[model samples]
Target: MTHTITGSAKLLARVRRIKGQAAALEGSLGEGTECMAVLQQIAAIRGAVNGLMLEVLEGHIREHLGPDASAAQRAEDTEAVVAALRSYLK
Candidate 1:
């Protein structure tokens, strides 16, 4: 939680940027913008979301699965994380 608290401002900024991107996408659609333009905005949103996921996952690994963790435990945690990420991205 301390990691989150300390990084709240940065995280919120990223979220706000994502929100702005979403709003832009909505506006583009409403205005009948080009399909490629809307698609580009969607791609940008996906990249932003992925970046946020990476940050959060890194924090989880550092905090929940510390450096001292056993190799087997680390492998298990890594597998679970990868599976969850695949499900989410899909």
Candidate 2:
């Protein structure tokens, strides 16, 4: 897909950043880092993952329903996406 091609670099960068965060978390644990610090790192990783999800969802919506789509269609699509994400992330 054009969205995938166009967004590959950005998405890969995010993935790499997430990997780095995971490595840091691992290293911190090895060094006996505090629990609070580890929790913060986990929270950052969750936020990054959510951001990636948003980007992919935006691309999916754009590709499937073009900008000229009706308002009701857009609303329905958005609701479905939100519901799916909420269910998945929980």
Instruction: Using TM-score, give the best candidate's number.
Output: 1
Q: RMSD of model 2, in Å?
A: 3.1
Error of 1 at 30 (Å): 0.2
Candidate 1 RMSD to the correct structure: 2.4
TM for every model, in the order presented, reads 0.79, 0.74
lDDT of 2 at 71: 83
Tens-digit per-residue lDDT, 59-81, candidate 1: 76886578877888889888988
Q: What is the lDDT of residue 24 in candidate 1?
A: 94
- Candidate 2's C-alpha runs over 4 A off are 67-87
